[model samples]
Target: MTMCPQCGSTFLQPLRCEAKGSDVLLVELRCSECQTWTKAPHTRADMKELDRQQAEFRATIVDGYERSVAESMEALATCFGHALELDLVTADDFRPRTASA
Candidate 1:
């Protein structure tokens, strides 16, 4: 994570935006010690940038399924082709698991 150029404090709250489609955003960060507020950008060249800022700040996990998209090109295409046929049923047709008790 990049440090704040203003306060020289390492405790920075980084944020992100997706609307720009290139650079994610760090809206505002209040320094823990100096109380300085700074703005930063955490970008992703792949995903579409988000316009509205969200406080939920959920982290995106790039699992084996995701990594293959970038690091391995052929594997991603193969997975996508196979996944298209996977069955997706609604709640009415769903089956619940039995209790072990």
Candidate 2:
């Protein structure tokens, strides 16, 4: 019987198994009360696969962030150009407004 480290509960539920490349099974257990997670023994292939998945997820997030920044920059440039063409250029226009003002 496994006990929860935080709450000392004896009810530890088996969540799932993360298996990779055969001969690699990691059993995850969660405490019913505190929601603390514990992992069983894992092989080298399991660790490698987990690392690879993490790297891929991080790369995807970065790609999305870069795309959003590029789109925002393009929009800002377009707005600035339009403002310039309309002769609405003013030093005060670029200044940030304060909540008090």
Candidate 3:
């Protein structure tokens, strides 16, 4: 993974990729987090490794988002349980109201 020299972020995206000839690639990378730009040379193997690392980062972010959503759902359930215990919710609250001026 290419790291941003400024903020140390490894989530750099490719702004451009060009052939340097003879098994070399010239890649222009921009950091997603810090907007830092860099140009570097890489082999095909290095590009593959960078792709793998980027996938790992994507998975990590998705996992964190899922965990956060699950926690929020649990907390909301607990809140509703408390509200029910306190009789804060009534049948009338679920009743449909007719539109009026």
Candidate 4:
């Protein structure tokens, strides 16, 4: 609920958030910037802000993962092209497997 007193950072990650009552929540947060831990009783508004921050972080992570996957696929395609040019990939590579009796 409060900024990190150690570093004045607002980037705090919730380690524990439990509903204390209908509108109050017991929150334990760890600061990302200075790794300081703090606990307090928070309101629903604080929980909403925390959820919003987490959603933004989730979106950022998903976007990064998508970009990484796309780059890896492109690299694999280029490698396949090089292999084809060098004749390292033959017709047999595409042939179906035959089972032994």
Candidate 2 clashing pairs, residues 3+ apart or interchain: none
Residue-by-residue lDDT tens digits, candidate 4, 1-101: 64777898778888988998999998888999989998899999987987887788789989999999999999999999999999899989999999988
- Deviation in angstroms for 66 in model 1? 36
Residues 24-56, model 1: lDDT tens digits: 543555666677776555555321222212222
**Which stretches of model 3 miss by more than 4 angstroms?**
95-101
Worst 10 residues of 4 by lDDT: 1-10
TM-score of each predicted structure versus truth: 0.32, 0.55, 0.79, 0.72
TM-score quality measure for candidate 4: 0.72
Clashing pairs in 1: 15-25, 17-25, 18-49, 18-50, 19-49, 19-50, 21-49, 24-43
| TM-score of candidate 3 to 2 decimals | 0.79
Task: Name the weakest run of 10 consecutive residues (lDDT summed) in model 2.
Answer: 45-54
* Models sorted by TM-score, best on top: 3, 4, 2, 1
Which residue pairs in model 4 clash with each other?
Answer: none
Clashes of 3: 0
Query: Against the unseen true structure, what C-alpha lDDT does each candidate score?
Result: 0.50, 0.75, 0.89, 0.88
- Count clashes in each candidate, considering only residues at least 3 apart in sequence or on different chains: 8, 0, 0, 0
Q: Write the per-residue lDDT of candidate 2 for residues 1-101, one digit (tens) a residue.
A: 24666798855666777665468677676887889998776675654565565577679989999999999999999999999999998889889988995
lDDT of predicted model 3:
0.89
Model 4, C-alpha of 4: deviation from truth (Å) = 3.4
- Overall local distance difference test of candidate 2: 0.75
